[model samples]
Target: MSLKVKFDELKTLAGTELGTSDWIAVDQDRINTFADATDDHQWIHVDVEKAKTGPFGGTIAHGYLTLALLIPLWTELLDVEGVTTKVNYGLNKVRFPAPVPAGSRIRVTGKLGDVEEVPGNGLQLTADLVIEIENGTKPACIAQPVFRFYA
Candidate 1:
């Protein structure tokens, strides 16, 4: 479930654990679509046959694919009311610690790190996020994403 809050209340939630998103499967079809869009058809990501003999023992989703999934997963975790606009400012840090094999399930958990005022009549939110693969040994991605909510 998402944490629904008003824009003005965001600051009060700093340092709070926002919670985890619902798990989504990273199937080959989605991986192929991302590969097509990004022109990143690396063997380990799309070449299922060859990838079977490659590292990870199967086809894996591209690192960026996992990173991109953060957007939808993030929206599932937080919903801010009373904002004119919401923008994904950018990421401060990102790391892919583990591969997400095709067909694997992934979910994200986040903590509201900081809430500060920005120049454009906006509130800047920094969230520390972790994307974990179900039953995997290590997290699929670790990222610090910044968001801006304008009044």
Candidate 2:
């Protein structure tokens, strides 16, 4: 279920599991677009046929590509209604534990963490995030993303 929280409620929810995002397909097209955008056309990520012989056994999504998807995925999980604006502060930690192969589906699960006040009537929100690959034993990515929300 989608959770809507106000500023105070957000603080209270810290350390609680948020929710999971809808499954998203990491297809060749999306991977190619990311490659073009970031100029990261590594054979293992953009070259499908050739990647069959490479590591991971096939084309895989760029680790950053998967991390970038967290924006939309986060929106699907929770909504902070009283914020005037929200900004991506930065990540505290990140890791890729498993490869996200092309044609695979993935989703993110998050938990609220620390919440601290920032300058100019803003709040810095932190969360522990994990991106899960469908049927995979290990998570594709783990991250702690911090966001600044202003009222």
Candidate 3:
């Protein structure tokens, strides 16, 4: 389900899970484009033939590509109304526990960890985000992302 809340209600939602994002496929085309844009044409991410025999047994997405999908996935899960600005403050920690094979489906689930007030009538939110693959045992990515929202 999607979460819609005012900026002020963030405090009340601390230490709770917001919601999970809709599933998104990680296709070879997407992996290839990410490799092209980032100039990271690693064989495991682009070369289908070579990657088939590679570690993951197929073309896998770049870790950062998986990481970068979090924000848009967040949009599917939650929407914060009554905020003038929202800034991606930074990440405290990030880890890739498993590889995301090309053509696999993945989604993110976010848990609100810490909520604190900042200067200029702003709120800082720390969310523990988990990206899991469809029918996969291990999570593809886990991260703690900090966001700043101004009222």
User: Which of the two candidates, 1 or 3, achieves a greater lDDT against the reference?
Assistant: 1
Q: How close to the true structure is residue 60 of candidate 1, measured as C-alpha lDDT?
A: 95
- List TM-score per model, in order: 0.98, 0.96, 0.97
lDDT of 2: 0.91
User: Clash pairs of candidate 3?
Assistant: none
Better of 1 and 3 by TM-score: 1
RMSD of 3: 0.9
What would the per-residue lDDT of candidate 2 be over residues 1-151, giving only the tens digit for each residue?
A: 5688886667677788888989999999999999999999999998888999997899999999999998988888889988889899899999999999999999999998998888988888899999999999999999999998888
Ranking by TM-score: 1, 3, 2
User: Please, what is the whole-model Cα lDDT of each candidate in the order they appear?
Assistant: 0.96, 0.91, 0.93
Model 1 regions more than 4 Å off: none
Compute the lDDT for candidate 3. Answer: 0.93
Best by lDDT: 1
Model 1 agreement with the true structure over 11-106: per-residue lDDT tens digits: 999999999999999999999999999999889999999999998899999999999999999999999999999999999999999999999999
- lDDT tens digits, residues 12-35, model 3? 999888778899999999999999
Q: After TM-score superposition, what is the CA distance of residue 118 in candidate 2 from its true location, in Å?
A: 1.0
> In candidate 2, which residue pairs get closer than 3 Å at backbone N, Cα or C atoms, i.e. clash?
none
| Poorly placed runs, candidate 2 (over 4 Å) | none
